[model samples]
Every structure is written in structure tokens, then in C-alpha cells.
Target chain A: MKRRLFLASSIAAALAGCSPIGTALNDNAGFHHALGLEGSLDAALMENLPGLAREYSIADISKNFPVDSLPTPTSVTYDRLLAHDFQSYTLAVVGAVERPLSLSLAQLQRMPQQTQITRHDCVEGWSAIGAWTGVPLRRILQFARPHRDARYAIFRCMDRDDQGTPYYESLDMAQAYQAQTLLALRLNGEAIRPDHGAPVRLRVPTQLGYKSAKWVREIQIVGSFAHLYGGKGGYWEDQGYEWYAGI
Target chain B: MQRLVYRYALLTRLAHWFGAIAVAVLISSGLQIFNAAPYLDAADRSTPTRRVLSIDSPADGIGRTTIFGHSFTTTGFLGWGSDGNGGEGARAFPGWLTIPAYQDLADGRRWHFFFAWIASLAWLSWLVSSAVKGNLAEMILRPSDLHKLWPMQAYYLRLRRDPPPHGSYNPLQKAAYTFVLLVLAPLILLTGLALSPGIDAIAHPLTMIFGGRQFARLWHFVGMLLFVGFVCVHIFQVLTQGFFNQMRSMISGWYRLREHESVGP
Candidate 1:
């Protein structure tokens, strides 16, 4: 009886100890700050190791690639663009640049195209491989002549999340210049479907799927997106997800 | 004669306790993370055909867990459970089983990664310390231990009158510790790294070794289950053998060997 009581007391103490840890960890600024530091360190170390994401063969493409964005943008602007086959759509390149320019779908398609098969890893722990064809984002950055002060490229999309906030994502200059970073126009030889970010989407294989902002309307180069949209850098990033979705 | 022997060293005790806390947090947070998807697919893409295990609540509000072709109603415990507010929600692992006891994937990931660092550092320190002290051999099962495995099992089963003569740990204990520390732990870490796209950018081969990224995720979950299994058996052993003595050894580094157990000079 004494031994059982001792065991019970010890377990109760251990459990009591655990509840404090949970309370201490939840929404703790210090822990979040530490996590951010770790993320930066991780990004720096990963930059040193092969800067390229492994590409797969065409045969490895997933037959049923899941669509991530829910409720598909139902805005009049999106519907109008979809009706017109995105012919009237113009991708504006603004902010921290020598020259702000607007390029149409036809103009973007005419640029140097890179076609590669790569895997898409979502933050929800699902993966899908698909072939994407598009113009390298660096070429567009070069065309616009980004100012030396530019540190991040913010991809603003037309789709609003559940709360009516516009979807946006950002990448550092280093990630923007990556060979695989594309303004993807085509998926699996066909023009991107409306549900899958029709006309254009940013394809960042190095980061998680959320970083690949779809239905991109503007590419705003900025010194820091900390001042823009919740100061966390992106829509999901503002909603408690890590700004650096590399993991 | 009952003898008091110095069993666990101070370093060992510290690492053990630290690891225990870190592991508990990691497991709970990890389950919370898994609750985001609540399905395991062997293929690269999580298609319906390849899904081996899944938990969900349909329009009926009844939670069900499906494994392969078999389905089980795990309502109120697994697929559907509450956060202690009497409001039963459709969460895979339930709130009580997770850190923060609520559906917050971001917080869960934060907790998971934070404790992961702690666990990894402790494991690294334990590894280096044990190697320096030349005490790693004590945890490793050897050819000589092969013969004692059956006798140890028989003793634990109460089929043998006398327990096997061992120093510090029995042969079975050595095997369990050997596998958990050397094989399982490192594999869990590696599989975890494979799930990260950042890590994949650097070490893509790590994902390929497990067939694919999705498979790596599956293997990582399996590794967590194995760790849970090991912990349950370990606690059971501690309770059966001598709870107070085992607890005292782990806490204060002194163990009281029973009268039947031989004592060294």
C-alpha cells in the first residue's frame, strides 16, 4: 500500500511538473525568439549545402496532385480574369527597383523558360511531384534592376484567405536568385488551372509549399516586409506559421 | 545482505531526467503536429489509394479510425475528443494528449522543435561522456550476453529461482538500451530531418534512403511509437524489480540491491 501510494504521488508530481512546462512554452516570447534564431541559423547552414532541390523524372509525377488553396478565389476580378483566359492580366513588378514594370502573360511566356520536375512538400506533411515550366524569377528581377537596398521579394496574390486577407509570401534575395525559383506558368504541359493559381505562381522548391504564392499579381521588392501585413512577412506567416518555411 | 551500491553516476542521472522531460514534450507536441493531417500514406503523394491509416469525422460527427481496410470507432478518445471543456471536437489525437491541450499546430511545432534541441543535445552529451568514461560497453549487448538472454527472460517470468548474475544491467536490459540508444534514437532524428524541405535541399539522399519524403514521415512516427513502447516496458520493469530502489538510483545515484542479489567487494 505504501509503495502504491508512493508511485501515485510520484506520478502526480511528474504530471504537475509537466503542466507548468506546457504553460511556460505556449506563446512564450523567449521561446519564439529562440526558434527564430534557430531558423536563421538553419537557413544559413543549409545555404552552404547544395543550393539546389533535387529534380525528379517526368514519370515520377503524381497522378493526383492535391489542390491546396481552399474555396478558390471567387472575387469578380479573379472571375473576370479567368473568363478572359488571363489575357488581360498584367504582373506588376514594383517597390525597391530601378524601374517598376508590368508584364503580361504573353510577355512572361516569351522569356527564357525552365522546365523541371520537382517535389512539393506542404507544411501539412504531404508531398507531390509535378513538372513545372516558367521563366526564372531572377531574369525578371534582372529586367527590373532591383536596387542594392532590396533584400526580399514579396509575392502578392489575388486570393484572399478565409478572413478576407490577401495571400502573400516573401523570399530573401538569395532564394529569389536560385536557379529553380521560377514564375511558374505551366504545370504538366498545360496552363495552370484557376484552382491551382492560374496564369502564374511563384515556385520555390527550397521552401515549403506555402511559400509558393499562387495567382501572383505583383512582385514587390522590399528592404524589409516587417512593416507590411502583420509584420510577419506573409499571410500564413502572420497567422503563427513560421516566416521561414524551409522546414 | 542488502547492499547499497553506486549505480547511476551524477552525469547519467542528469541526462536521464533531462531526456525524460524532453521526450515527453516531444511526443505530445509531435502528436499534435500529426493531428494536422491525421493520415499516413506510403507513397510520395498522400493519395486515397496509398493511405494506410487515417482518422476523421464525417457529417455524422462520429470519429473513426481506419487502418488499411479495417475501421474502428475511436470516438471521444482518438478521432474525436475534448480539451476538458466538455465540448467534444474532431481532433485526431485529442487535446489532453497534446501539449497546450488545444489545436495549435504552430505552438505544437514550436514546442516540438524546442524540446527536440534539448533531447538532441542531451543525447550528444551522454554519448560523448559515456565514450570518455568507457562505459558504453556496459549498455551494449555482446556475444557472451547471448547465452544469458533466455535465463534473464525466464527469471523475469518467475520461472527461474535465481536471477542471472549481472553487473549494473541484465542482458535483456542491455539489449533494450543498446537498441533504443544506438539504433532507434538516431533513426528518429534522421527521419525527422528528411521531413524538412530545408534539410532535403541539402541532404536529399536522406529522404531517398527511406524511399521518399512521405515514407520518412511514416518511419519517424513508427520510431516514436517504438520509443513509447520502450518507455512503458521500462517503467513496468522498474516497478516490478524495485520501484523505490530504481527511483533512488536514478535520482540520488545509490541503489539498494535485494538480499538474494550478490554483492561485489
Candidate 2:
């Protein structure tokens, strides 16, 4: 009887410890932040972590890298830029910065650059490898000189959804400052095509594909994403996808 | 008269039940994720020569199931479905079998990762404890034990009524347990880690070894199916051998041995 009682109690304790109910409750409260494993595992993995994404050789690149569903820019500003071959286009760097600068494509390309062949894993269960060439996001952040209170870097995209809400994504300071994170201008030795994120796109190798905001138009440094569109971190994130998307 | 013998330790029993629950959760939630992208394109016709399985849908954007070169429309049941309003939807596994039972991929992932962590921890602890307790030796098959498997199979097939001389575990049981613990469990965990984008970045070689992330996902799905099959067979065997006795042994750590039975050497 004593043994049975002990076994019963131990099993009950184990079940309680292993239950998802507690985690689900915490998730519902938004105390955990992000979505799914992103809030837990991704956050834990990024805590004070140094550059985590690995670079691959050019030989490892996939011949046919998948082009994710690209949204065409319907705004007049984007259409005018596209009409003029993006010659008059400028990337605006704003919010929580000492020097809020607007950089043209050529000017941005002149900055210190890094090229990496990395794998892009989609959350929907596909992977593609490609060679990405561009300036490191850390260099851009350094140029912007983010304020001490700035905790997140938000990417404002030119693309809009069916509702005309502009697509946007954000990265925590740690990820933004990662060595591999880039504002990619080229893929596979050529200028990025329209099917892929053309002109420029954020390439966060550590994150899932959706976190790499395509057709980036603006960069905003913010302390919190509470006032942003939908309050969640990204376009997909607002619609139930995980914001941290590291996996 | 029957002799009461200790068949399982408290920790072992606890681990067994814990592992079972963890696997159940993992499998169901995994199916939910699989439903998100259900098509497997073994041949990327774009490249013509390069053959690799992809989770991307075919040209028509409709998911298909191919068996020995015969293809069938698996959209509604397999990869895509109706959103309950006659609109096109994506549903992999049915709602009842999934963790959230809704189309929330994020929630499904949380449930999966939560249980995956628990299961992995339990498995590691079980391995360490089993080693310390010298239980590993009993679980492994001996050269002579190979001979016993035939007779056990014959008995199971009803060719012989009497059960082979009682042992800690029958040859078939040992084989099944060994496969589950040493093979399927490790494969599932490794493949799962390979599928994680964050983990893949750190451990590129692990994913590369499996060809890619999609391949890892495919193998992980296959592993879940194998695990379900194993559980079904395990329960059936338990019921046929003596349901109450097996249940009592696992629950109470004591099994009543028949008078004619002798523990194996």
C-alpha cells in the first residue's frame, strides 16, 4: 500500500511537471512572448549568445533555391521607384537613433560587405540554399547608432497585404547585431529578381524564412512593438505565426 | 501455487509511462505540423537530374500521394482541405488527432516542443539509470537468445500452446524494446533537431547528413508511424499474454509467476 501510494504520488508529480497546460497558460498571457517554441527555445538560445548561424561553402549552394511568395509593391512610391528602375529609391533609417539617415542603394552598397552561402529553412517545412551578398546589418546598425534604450530593430517593407497593410518584421537587438545578418542586395552572383525579394531584403540566417522581411523600405529602432501594426512582431506573426521564428 | 517476483523497478515503470505520454503528444502535434505542407516531391523536375524530396507542392498546387508511380488526389484529406465554409483550406491530419485540434500551427508547435523536451530528458535519465542498474545487459539480445525467438514466434502463432520457459522478457519483446529505445527514439530526436532551423544553423552537418531539412521531416513522419505501429503491437501482445498480470507487474512492480515457470538464465 505504501509503495503504491508513493508510485501514484510520484507519477502525479511527474505529469504535472511535464504538462503543457502551464506553458499554454503562460503563452496565452503573452508573458512568454513570440509564438510556439519561438518564445521558449528561441529566446533561450538567443540569450547572450554570440553568432550562431554557420556559413557554408559556395559548392554547397542549392541549384534551385525556392522563391517564397513575393508580394508586389502596390504603393505609388514603390511603383514610381520601380518605373525609374529604383534609381531614385532611398532606404530610410529612422526611430531611436542619433543619426537617422536615408541611404540610396548605391550608397548602401558602398558600405563594408559580406557574402555567405547559407540555408533558408521555411516554417512550412522546406529548405533552400543560396549565396547571399550584401552589407552586414551590424554595420548598418553601427551607422545608425541605435539609442541605448532601443531593444528591437523593425524592418518596414514596401509590400502590402490584400488589406493594404504594409508588411513588417522586427528582430531583437541580439539578432540584429549578429555577424551573419545582412541587408542582401544580390543572390547567386546576380541582382535579386522580383520573384525573390528584389532591390533589398533582410537575410537573417538564424531565423525562419518569414522573418527575413523582403522589399525593405525603412528601418526603425524601437524599445517595444506594442504600438506597431497588430502589436505582434511581424506580418505573419500578427496572424498567429511565431515572431521569434529562430527555428 | 504461484511465486510473486519483482518484474519492474519503480523508476523504470515511471519512465515507461512518462515516455509513452511524451511520444503520444509529440506524434499528434507533429502530424499537425506535417498537415501544413503535406506533399513530398521526390523528384525536382526543374533540375531534371537532381532527385531530392521537397515539401513544396507540385505545379498544380494540389497535394498528391504517389504509390509505385500511381498518383492520387490527396488534397482534402492529406495536404489541403475545406476551411469549414466551403473555402479552400490546408489540413494535414484530422482535428481529433492533433494537439490543438484547430488550424493554429504556432500552438501545435508549442505542444510539440514542450513534450519533446520532456521526452528527451526522460530518455536520457532512463539510459543513465539503466546503465547504473545493469538493466542494459538484460535488454540486449544474446547469441543463444536468437534460437529462442523461433519458438516464441511459433507459440504466438498458436502452433504451440505453452509459453516458452518464462524469462524476464521474451526474445521478441527484447527485440521490439531494443528497436524502440536504441533505434526509433534516437532517430526521431536526431531528425527532429535536424528539422529545427536554429539547431540546423549550429549543426549543419547533422542536417546535411540526412540530405536536407525536408528529408529529415519525412523520416520524422515515418518514425512516428512506426512508433504508433509498435504501440499497437505492444498493447495487443500485453492483452494476449495476460492483460491483468502484465498491467499489475508494470503498475505494482510485482508479477505472479505460474508454478511451472522458471526464470531464464
Candidate 3:
């Protein structure tokens, strides 16, 4: 009897935690979406469908179906990413820098640290709080010492939308300069999974969680965010989510 | 000699006492719920609400009391009767942390929830034992309970307590407790789990079961209505029942019956 009680209690607790961080973070919005008042799934599926059919030409049905249109909740695996292997992962801190050089993941880890328990606010509206740890973004920018012209920190990721739209997000240089900003390498006391931007992601508190882009491949210290796709600088922005999902 | 016959069983007594304590804490924390909704409390919380929460609690140095939803111990210094209903600007918890807490309202709500699981388990165990030994009515209900529910409602509405030995529990009392345990508690748990965001794969199915978060939220509100109804009915019953006799049964597990024998064979 006691054993049954214990099992039931533990299972309930486990069920409560079933939401993985990504989907879990968006639960509030997910709930609304489930009710048809909001829809992340439909948005995701429809967002990718057109390019999906185009990518899987009748000619290359096998390759394109596997890559572009197979699923709704599929993990964005690292092998498909050009810099999936952290050993080979390289990030070029360029632009206003006095010294522009490519560095490996190990080299980046050797830099200074910043940790914050920030909320990851998805456009869908649920949020999750996790402690993020990484090098202070401002310290890196200070090293870069942007010319007076520099205004934005353009982030490019290893993954991209099918239209060859690279997953990129930008922080206003001033926001990036906040000590809390970081090239986060860990989440909730653990190294990140490839699906969650294995080598590096941005951790910025205050802004909605999605701004903490994962799979960071490049950090270009630039004067303008003009050239980024849709001129909004991120993957979901091209998909019609608001540019700033604060709160 | 006035001897006491056993009424509430030992385990049940334990469960009841714990459940009472839990409710007390929840009601205390519930101040946070009201404070969260800023439009409600118009006046400041520092001053007591003489209008609604005029707690006629005995002067301290006795036991415990709740005024304005804050706890007052026998010691007077700790009691800060900040009425959550009277003012809006003052907060129950810091603002930024509060909403995110609701975002995971299912999380800490789990603390409240798990105890409910224990409460249910404890109740069921007690109930099964009572049913097996044929002591169910003594513990759960009695023939007198029928008239008890709506009985004092009339007296309370009119202000008279002529017919006193009105039985174990009023129909209003029976229904209120039953609904909170059977309906509101379960609805709160299910809807809470549904709001869990799709963490558990089963959470997705729960969304489907409840029709979605908005629908679950609606169901939760319905359960809250049942609770509010029960509350109104419960307070009315309390007023109708002689406060001392009924309260003694609740607090000390012994009701001092005027009659020489127990009702019902």
C-alpha cells in the first residue's frame, strides 16, 4: 500500500516535469495555442511548408523530404549544421575588433564568466527561468572596441531556415554591453544540447527568452543590423513573430 | 458521569488536523492571490478592514487567530493584519517574480497539490476502514445531518437559533465539504496539471482532455465558483450551529451532546 502511494506520488511529479525546457518554456502560450486562441504548431508547420515542397523537388524526393519536410517537432540535429562539432566549431569576433580572429569552442570557454537566472519568454508567451552561464558579452565587445559607428551585435547561428535564411539575432550594442549579456555555454548547470545550440548561445535577461539565440556560429560587431534577413535579425522574425517579444 | 464516545478515528483525526493546518496556510498564502489582482484592494493594507474582515478573535494569549488573512499567534507582536481585499497597490509578493511564478504556477502549486494527494489518500483510507467496520455515518454523516444543511440558513438569514440540536452537519455543510473535496480539489489539480505546458507527453493529452488551457482555466473558474458557493454556505452553517459545540467537535474531536445517547442505532 505504501509502495503504491509512493509510486503514484512520484509519477505525478515526473509528469509535471515532462515538458522539456524549450516546449516547457512556452507552456502558457502552448496552452492557448492548444485551445486555438494561439498556434505555435500551425505557425511552425505553415512557416516551413512552402520551402519544404520546393526543397523536395520530385527529382530529389528522398533527400529533400528527409531534410526539409519530415516533421513538426523534429530536433534540429547538429550533423546538418556545418560547425556541429565543437572541436571544429569556430566563431569569428570581427568588425570593430582590434584583432579579428577565429576561435574554437575550448578557447571561448577560457574567457570570463557571467551568470543570471533569466526568463526565456517565447513569442508563444510561456516562460522558463534557468541560470545561464558564459563570458560577459560586454567584455568581449570592449575587447572589440567598436568604432563610434558600431551600433549592433549581429549573431549568426549554425542552423537556418530552408530559404537559406540563417538563424540570426541581434542585440542593440547597448543591450549587448550590459554585464548580464553573455555567450552562454551552459544552462541550468549543464552544458547545452546540440538541439539547444550546443557550443554557444546568447543569454540576455529582461528581453524575451527567444532572443537568447542558440547554436551561435558568429558574432559580428557591426554598426548597423541593416543586412540581416527581414532586417529584423533573427529566424522567427522572418517567420512573422514580433521583432521584440519582451515581457 | 459524562463519558466521551469515540467519534472521529485516529488516522482520520490526523488527516483532518493536517488538512486543517494546510487550509490555514493556503488561506494565509491566498492573500497573495488577491494582492496579485491590483484592481481589488482600493485602500491600504496596513489598516484593517473593519467592514469585511472584522475578526472577533479573542484577545491573544489564547490559541491562534486569522484576521485579514494574516495569521495571529498567541503572541501579539507578529500579527500584521494586512487585508488583501481592501487595497490594490501593496503586493503579496514582489511583482516580477509573481507572474513568472504563475507561468509555472503548476510548479509551486505542486507543493500545495501533493499534500492534497496525501489528504485524499488519507481520507480514502479512513473511509474504507469506516465502511468495512460499519462506522461510516458516525464519522462521515448522520440522520441529523439532513436537516443540518439548510437549517440554520433560515435562522441566519433571520437571526434566531431556537431549534438548537440541529444534528451533526447541515445539508449545506455536507454539500459544501463534499464539493470542495470531490470537485474543486480535483478540478484544481487537473487544470493545474494541464497548465503545466506540455512537459509530460501526457500533459498534451490532458490539454485535449480539458479542451485546452483556456478551457481548463474556465473549468478551474467553475470549480472556484463551487468553492465560493460552498464558502457562503459553510459560513452560514457555522453561524447557525452553536459555535462552541460544533467548533469543539472540529478542534478537539469531541462534541458535547445534550442527549444521553448517540443518535441512530
The best candidate by TM-score is 1
In order, the interface RMSDs are 2.3, 6.2, 17.6
The full ranking of all candidates by TM-score, starting with the best, is 1, 2, 3
Residue A31's lDDT within candidate 3 is 42
Q: How well does candidate 1 reproduce the true complex, by DockQ?
A: 0.56
Cα deviation in Å at residue B177, candidate 2? 0.8
Task: Give the number of the best model, judged by lDDT.
Answer: 1
DockQ, prediction 2: 0.29
Extract clashing residue pairs from model 2. Answer: B35-B92
Distance from true location, Cα of A149 in model 1, Å = 2.2
Please give, for residues B185-252, the per-residue lDDT of candidate 3 as tens digits.
Answer: 66665764443332212234664476543344445545545655665565445444445565566666
Best by DockQ: 1
Q: Which regions of candidate 2 deviate over 4 angstroms?
A: A1-38, A46-48, A51-64, B3-6, B41-63, B73-90, B160-167, B259-265
Regions of candidate 1 where Cα sits further than 4 Å from its true position: A5-24, A27-37, B83-86, B260-265
True contacts kept of 3: 0.00
Give the CAPRI class of candidate 1: medium
Per-model C-alpha RMSD: 2.3, 6.2, 20.9
Q: To one decimal place, how large is model 1's interface RMSD in Å?
A: 2.3
**Which segments of model 3 are wrong by more than 4 Å?**
A1-247, B1-3, B27-170, B198-200, B203-205, B228-236, B259-265
Chain B TM-score of every predicted model: 0.94, 0.82, 0.52
